[model samples]
Target chain A: MNRRALLGTAAAATFSGAMPGLVRAQAPGIKVGFVATLSGAGAALGTQLRDGWLLAVKHLDGKLGGLPAETLVIDDELKPDVAVTKVRAALERDKVNVVAGLVYSNILQAVFRPVTESGTFLISANAGPSTFAGRGCNPLFFTTSYQNDQVHATMGQVAQDEGYKRVFVMVPNYQAGKDAAAGFKSRFKGEVVDEIYVPLTQLDFSTELAKIAAAKPDAIFTFMPGALGVNLVRQYRQAGLASTPFLSSFTVDESTLPAQGEAALGFYTAANWAPDFPNEVSRRFVRDFEAAYGYVPGTYAAQAYDAAMLVDDGVKQAGGRLADKAALRAAMEKPGFTSVRGNFRMGANHYPVQDFYLCKVAKRPDGKLATETVRKVLSEDTDPYAAECRMR
Target chain B: MSLNLLLVQLLNGAQLGILLFLVAAGLTLVFGVMDFINLAHGVQYMLGAYVAATLGTLLGSFWLGLLLALPVSLLIGLLLEWVVFRHLYRRDHLAQVLATFGVILTVEDAVRAIWGSSPLAVPQPEGFAGGIEIMPGLTYPSFRLAIIAAGLLVALGLWLLVDRTRAGMLVRAGATNAPMVSALGVDIHKLFTLVFGIGAMLAGFAGALAGPVFAVAPGMGDGVLILAFVVIVIGGIGSIRGAFVAAILVGLIDTLGRAMLPDLLRLVMDASSARQTGAALASMLVYIVMAAILFLSPAGLFPVRRG
Candidate 1:
């Protein structure tokens, strides 16, 4: 419509034709796609991941390595097929050179191979399965989160250090659940009373709780997150066993902790990040996030924040050129992005080899629920399976 | 293990049975009376749990929350039936299923829009939170026993209403032939509304009862809906007595299979193998029972009187 616009379009076309190589030399904005379950049972965690990413991008003021950035977000709905298809669309249609934000290990496994094989960069915010941390690791895959086994292994170490001799293990019957159990058993050298594996979405835990109580272990450890975590904590409290020491690998996050309230009090949990880690970056994230969102950010948010920062560092390292996939990835391999969890370095397997903190819920000096940094459970904890990762 | 351990497992099995009966009772009635398959019935259960959690959190009392949630859920259930479910009454099973499936999507989304998709935990009553030692060595959750008692009471009340009262006569007759009941000067639409509302209330009640135990989140109804359908298939679609007994049987078998099968397997194998094999077998127990029942009695133990 405007005479000036038509003239600009004609001149732009002529200019683009004249300098084809100039386009490659110029600063190109990075396009990244994020896929996760954004509308189902795990939707809250997914939203947290999304928010963290947006906040990181917001902090960057729409720039990664001095070039503007664009993000493509898709909802996976917790279905493997849908997640895979979404990844393909983001890569092929959206033309995003890098993909990030996988919440579940199952979804990550469904996503990792396709993007890696296609020579696209995948920056995983969460869900680094041991296989990918180990023999299945690919050069294109980089996880900001620790391997799933690393967290569980640290949990086991916490239990062992606490002098727990008899423990009952419970996890939903699934691949990840089995992995959680095996990883814990690898580090835990105590007497195990029983291992009860229930269906993934089982609601009624009365029978299972009875069995757990019957085993009468010194302590009970479980691996159930999302809805399962809420259900288990509520039912465990209802089972009149609150006094019993409960250890969990993936529970007691900001997402579930508020809903749990006093019920989560005194529970021991292990994680790579917590709100009270005493780091300036983490403290600021907690303070500002609490003031803004009216709730604390969980590990889900923390991992996602790290993921975005990692991408930012990679883009900057590549001198703002995301089109060169290997150059951008090589830039990502060296770590200097200060995440909320302090400086995290990528290990040989592409998963973060970071510190694991054994934390217990206790009322701080102000009578607000916060995690007590019980101990640095593992320093520079690397996955045993990582040696098998053949990432070039 | 020991005798006390056996008693505890049995008690657990019975508790799960009672809860399943509460959910199955409504589903069987809806199918048997109206010849309508309502897939969103479980969504009402989710609504009930949500209402209870939000109300309980606001009021700081579990019982009060349950009380306040009942009317809200009932009104919601009736409105949904009037606006959505009533239209599907004349539709075929395929159409009804599709429409109700849409309802599931709308309701789950509505919950997410309102509650932000986080699992909300409703605390148990102060009194019922703890278990009671029934025997010298065995203790069972008092709240679970209360559930069993409540389920039995509802079952008895339903039996009296369907078998002993004049309204019961009409319902039974309507199950046999709705057109004939309409010919006797009763409005069929009114009957359908009443039946749908009651079925929804039962589902809401089950949802309410389960709130303290399970997290109230979007799509929590899916697993429960599948189990309730299994109950209907085994108990006979329209028969209330069949629903109750079949619900209990299925619940017991599923729960006990999960709890005991692995230990029983350990009688012959090592603990690890027994755990793995038992976990798999336990999950398959209910389906296996459903298959056996279908094989033995083609139309369930008691078919609806439509034929």
Candidate 2:
């Protein structure tokens, strides 16, 4: 074949190649591909995730599951098309045994087909969209992160329990935002006086703040992450609505707390894991992460670190063998992996069945904002859509 | 919405308008007088905020930081013009856009490298940090009111500078006919450089003012840049007055539309449909107005047409 034809043949091999990413018996080397958004607006989260993943690699002495492994990390740049293309390249060109590390839901959903259809095990460190938690669940896909709605649902339950009779909901207008609102409304007992879906890129919340003030809700619940989150929280306080008791889910994270400064103080939130979670693994992870990186790891980092650890456990269980997809998948599902968030188990749909914690932003002894896990809202909870997942 | 709510929303719109005007004023003048399209203009805004915030931490006072940031931002703007933008002045708009877009990427990456990707907090200036009661049972944030006053002051300053000064007359003349100004013993190159420098300073000033309210991050300028462009196009390419009018118009329409559309739609439609349609329509309202204005007057609302 000509050179162009040879390239085309290799490209075609991605589709027609028999059980595309089966580990070669001769090589027996594990190659894991990580795709996360490491650039653009919300890149700090991706950076922390990459750092945690790398720290896991370091802790393992450059081995996963007691076998020598190679990891290739790529930036998706927060674009779905770019993520899809990069994953394809990772599978086809690099021919990795496993794929991991996605921070955005839309990008994860975009790359789900290509990564899974190639018979490559895809472990998501973050972003478990609802589509994959239900009837659409794929056997080849596994998520170390909670379903996207899990934290929001916990917050909803918290708001209901707190006796907040009137709540104003605010979130960006997108799929994740819609999912968040739905999650909150499903469990919130209060009357939703107003549910405002602002544009995703909107930075100024004065108008929204004005509207919230007029409505005079008992509490304000918002799901804005990254820069938008920082902007919203700061503006909320600036608008003198700080007295209204702000609540959120993953919007006032450790990554954004510095930017929020004093404004983030006393804000209520819910998430799967926090730095102050009382566990040896959590403490060690947090300490080692801070010592190694000179900053505390947020939930994204914790999640990615867990993903790496889980992958390591799976490899160890498989006796350094991931060539058999079923064997590896079964191994990953086993309990007692020493996760930073303790006692993690995969539901039938492959999303985590873990505890969700109600958290608050408090200043640490060192004068840094950190999430303190106040109470457990959902213990060993599985997603609602897990019953719909046929993979069980 | 109640009358008080309406009034608040209008104020919100006006505040947003003034900020937009601050950025668009610089953008329109540069496009108008120099005939240069600098996509990196937004990055100047970003740089201003970054400088202000960084210095604010180092200086221990927001006012002092602002005082120091202005000169530093102006210097950086002038340096950018000297090193990168001067070469692009003779290029076509597409080439200028492509080159300046490259500058945007470089500047944003440079910012990320220097000051990580996390947003930075810039404390609001003292005495304007909280809200105040303007009427019975009504209170508004003092910082926003301060922003409005400052923006209007800058607008007035710009008007006086452009309309009342000899240099201003030259700029107006240059906007109308650069070659004629050049033929009349005026050094158009210096004029262009000065205009570019002033535009950068204006954008940076706006950025510094906005740092307290908005998230000071690497790509924060991208959104405002697009809106500033819209303001200039809708108002008139070369007219500062056009930019001012259009900036406020765009701001009010955007703010008020987003605030009131769903409620208005709820009166006629079901709640769910009203919300969905209202949000969709509200986002498109500004563009729709732009389209209608363009259709009605192809030269824009205040085109700088000379007989």
lDDT agreement with native, every candidate: 0.79, 0.84
lDDT tens digits by residue: candidate 1, B145-206: 77889899989988898899987788888889888889989987887777777888888888
Q: What's the number of clashes in each of the models?
A: 2, 0
Which residue segments of model 1 deviate by more than 4 Å? Answer: A1-28, A323-327, A363-371, B134-139, B302-307
DockQ, in order, for the candidates? Answer: 0.36, 0.41
Ten-residue segment with the worst summed lDDT in candidate 1 chain A? A16-25
Please list the Cα RMSD from the true structure of every candidate, rounded to 1 decimal place. 7.2, 5.8
**lDDT of model 2, residue A44:** 78
Candidate 2 lDDT over B50-108, as tens digits, reads 99888988887887777777888779888989998899888889999998998888788
**Candidate 2 residue-wise lDDT at A321:** 69
TM-score of 2: 0.93
> Which candidate number has the best lDDT?
2
Residue pairs with clashing backbones, model 2: none
lDDT of 1 by residue, A1-392 (tens): 23322332233223222211111222356777877556666777776776677667767876656677777666677778888987898888867778899888888878878888888988889877776877778888898988888888888887798899998999889888898888888889999889988888688776777777766778888988878887887777767766668888887777787667677788888889887878888887777666655556778888888898898898888877667777887778886778788858988778888899988877666556666678798998888887777776
- Distance from true position, residue A163, model 1, in Å? 2.4
